[model samples]
Target: MSKVTNLNQFRKQQARVKKREQGSVNAEKFGRSKAEKALQESRATKERRDLDGHQREHDE
Candidate 1:
């Protein structure tokens, strides 16, 4: 004989597990530390500055 289970409780537990899984996926996708973000920002700024420095001045 199989053990009896409450259907409603089982459904809720399934939903919770799915939600937790989604949360972890999202965390991996979007999680970043402040230092990491700052480093990225600084790199971008330096790249932009370097690019701008290479532009030629034109007089009309």
Candidate 2:
């Protein structure tokens, strides 16, 4: 006689693996590190400051 395994357990394990894969994909697509976000914000601030510095004051 051959050993019998629980089919429900196998299905649950398969579902868990699929969920784990989806979570990883979502994290990669939607996640950013703090340092990366900070760097982007820093660059944007610098650009804005430079643009403002170059603007001439106009009196109307």
- RMSD (CA, Å), candidate 2 to true, equals 3.1
Write out the backbone clash pairs for model 2. Answer: none
- Determine which window of 10 residues in candidate 1 has minimal summed lDDT: 25-34
Query: Where does the lowest 10-residue lDDT sum fall in candidate 2?
Result: 26-35
Residue range 1-60, candidate 2, lDDT tens digits:
999999999999999999999999999999999999999999999999999999999999
The number of the candidate with the highest TM-score is 1
Question: C-alpha displacement of 28 in model 2, angstroms?
Answer: 1.3
Whole-model lDDT per candidate: 0.99, 0.99
The estimated TM-scores of all candidates read: 0.69, 0.59
